[model samples]
Target chain A: MKTLVWVEHDNSAMADATLAAVTAAGKLGEVHLLVAGSGCRAVAEQAAQIAGVGKVHLADNAAYANALAENVAPLVVDLMSHHDAFVAPATSHGKNITPRVAALLDVMQISDILSVEGEKTFTRPTYAGNAIATVESTDAKLVITVRGTAFDKAETTGGSATIEDVSGAGDAGLSSFVGAEIAKNERPELTSAKIIVSGGRALKDSETFQQVIMPLADKLGAGVGASRAAVDAGYVPNDYQVGQTGKIVAPEVYIAIGISGAIQHLAGMKDSKTIIAINKDEDAPIFQVADIGLVGDLFKIVPELTEKL
Target chain B: MKALVPVKRVIDYNVKPRVKADGTGVDLANVKMSMNPFDEIAVEEAIRLKESGAVTEIIAISVGPAKAQETLRTALAMGADSAILVETDDEVEPLAVAKILKAAAAEVQPGLIILGKQAIDDDSNQTGQMLAALMNLPQGTFASKVVVEGDSVTVTREVDGGLETVKLSLPAIVTTDLRLNEPRYASLPNIMKAKKKPLDVKTPADYGVDITPRIKTLKVAEPPVRQAGIKVADVDELVAKLKNMGVA
Candidate 1:
């Protein structure tokens, strides 16, 4: 089976999630990486070094600079004639593009598979991770999005692969880029962070949430996360949200301050290696999954814990 | 110009789904069903656009069981002008649903199509993008804010890193995210009036589309349970435990 993995990059550097996706694609058979962007030769070069990749298909074009699904899906569909399966990371970018590819190819796209059970079968979480479903595809070709946290990252070095220049499906002229407001943070990215400090609605306003959550996150060199309630209440940016609908993080250590652990919130971070919950409510559902439960007022405990750390 | 919004009937967001004993799938018997939350936002956005005079009419659509009419009525109560239900009993996958919606869009001829980013049941965030691809139209997905100007629309999308703004020509697709708008409850008068609104029921065959299962379910099971751990007495103890774990 020949598999094509879309390399996730920011035009200059490849994302860690792509390495994890490469690991998932390695299970199918020979892995080929597709790097499509303007001036993204460095990304293709980076993709060529992954341990098991056999070939890197580079589509360097000005049209793909924004990575619009309109242009990228046609390129992927054209490539699907040679490949048996296409795999991508379950990031926002991947989610936006893979379905379009599947629809164009007239195949069903499986979103966010956690495990590759066989050549045709895979397991994925549904109903906010409360249930897992194993599904097998009958389609001639398969399109999948891999949950990066569920797979190990492929070795960044060792094996060599060939990079081939492929022409892009230039400018579909469907959507135009306007502007972006990405948060500039010095801390780690949430999905790849080793430690995460998450706030909940109990943090009150945005001011208090930052005052309490940021210092602790900084002290631990951790990523900042927030419950959906906190994000909906305007305590943080939408990117800081960690829940079923938000970013999923399986950090080495996850600290939940003043979080009551709604099922949706737990769905995102319950896989953390060690979970610590500090809440005034003794019976908060978060305590059930927390490895270390601290029943106290976070206003006092979080600051004190930050100082002690 | 008219706006087309597609809603879905799914297990309510707050309900905890249970895997059946035989592991076929999640048990939906006696479960409270509602319009997918994101679709509620889509309907709300459409209604708001109508109120703002950007949209002349709002047409809500759903592809599900006959009971989906109830979901459509909810959209009507929320102020949609009319609704269509492509009734089906079989589980419709995203690609097929997109095809059905493509046919519906052809018949409705709306200037804008809005849908939920994903239904909470299957959690497959694909329908809107797939429909866009099938129709060869531009897509602004996971939209937090949408502004419709004459022949184009500017949408603010909730992407992984942060917000991205994109402009799409008329007859584009936009999927709702959480921050789009807070859906309002249908007042009693609206509920009473919604029953009188026009609801057209049809099937996939009417659109010359085939709705078949392309994926076979091997099993349905519960996720691994996380065991509760020890409780620390104080902040010092918590800090000590973290040090021992080499995390801090």
Candidate 2:
């Protein structure tokens, strides 16, 4: 199987999620990294160094400045004829673009695949990760979004693959980027972090969330996260949400501070190696999955825990 | 301008799905079914558009079994003027649903189409994008904010890093994210009025779409259970435990 792994990247560098996609694609067959962006030659050069990748396809275009699905879907469509498999990290960008490409190919896409059993068979979670379904696609082209956390990233500094320049950079005139308001933080990104400290609705307010959670996260050098309730309550930005709807992370350690575990939130972090919970309610569902559960006020427990560390 | 919204009836977001004893599929025998949470957000956004006088009419469309009519009625109660039920007992794949919705869009020629980013049942986040592809329309997926102007709509989408704003031409597709808007509950009067609103039921064949599954469900089963551990007396004990396990 010839697999084209969509290498998600900024103009200057490749994203860590792409390395996981590369590993998943490597399981299929020859892997090629597709770096589509404006002046992404540096990113392409980095992608070519991944161990399993055999080649790098560059679709340098201004239209793909933000990886807008409208502009990138056609580029993916143009390259579809050359591969039997199309795999991408199940990130926001991949989720946005891969479906359009699958639709253009007239195939049902296998999304958030947890494991690849065969060329067409895959295991995926549905119903907010409550049930696992094994599905086999009959489509000629297997278009899939691999769960990034489930696979180890392919070796970063290894082989050297040739970068090929591909054309078809026409804008659909359908959509345009209107800028972004991203959070400015020094902590490791939640999805890529080795450890995570998450707040819930119990954080009371945004000030408390920062006062109680950020210090602990900083002390541990971990990413900060929040449950959907906290985000909905405006205690944190939507991007900080760690749930089935937000980011799924399987870090080395996941500390649930004040978050009562909903199945939605559990879907994201239940796969972590070690889980700790600090909540006032002893009956919180978070305790059911915690390796170390502390029944106390997070405001007091978190600060004390931070000071101890 | 007319806005079209698609709703899916799935196991209530609150109810955990129970894999059937034989594992053919989820056991919906007596479980509670509700409109997908994301679709509720979509309906709310469309209703807001109507309330703002940006759209003259609203249509709720659902592709599922006869029970899905109830889902459409809920949408109508939420403020949609009318409803369309694309009847099918088949396990319709996203591609097929996209085709059916494509046909509806062609006949209605709506200025905007809104749908949930994904369905909870299958967790397939492909229908809206697929429909956009089939209809050759622009798509703003996982949208948190939508501002419709004369010929274009600016939508703020929920990306991984942050919110990303995209301005798409009118007659585009917009998929709802969780933060789009809080969905309003149907009042008694609106529920009664929804019964009076027009609802047309038609099979997938009416749209010349074969609601066939392109993917085979080999098996469905329970996920691995997490082992619950002992509760620590306090934070000190918790940290001690983490250190002992070399996880701190």
- The sequence of per-residue lDDT tens digits that candidate 2 reaches over residues B78-116 is 899999999877788999999999999888889999999
DockQ of every candidate structure: 0.90, 0.84
> Which residue pairs clash in candidate 1?
none
lDDT (0 to 1) per candidate: 0.94, 0.91
Q: Which clashing pairs does model 2 show? A: none
Q: Write candidate 1's Cα lDDT for B85-114 as tens digits.
A: 999999999999999999999989999999
The Cα RMSD in angstroms, rounded to one decimal, for candidate 1 relative to the true structure is: 0.8
List the TM-score for candidate 2's chain B. Answer: 0.98
Badly placed stretches (over 4 Å) of model 2 are: none
CA shift at A253, candidate 2, in angstroms?
Answer: 0.4
Task: Give Cα distance to truth, residue A171, candidate 1, Å.
Answer: 0.5
Considering summed lDDT, which 10 consecutive residues are worst modelled in model 2 chain B? B239-248
Backbone clash count, each prediction separately = 0, 0
Error of 2 at A33 (Å): 1.2
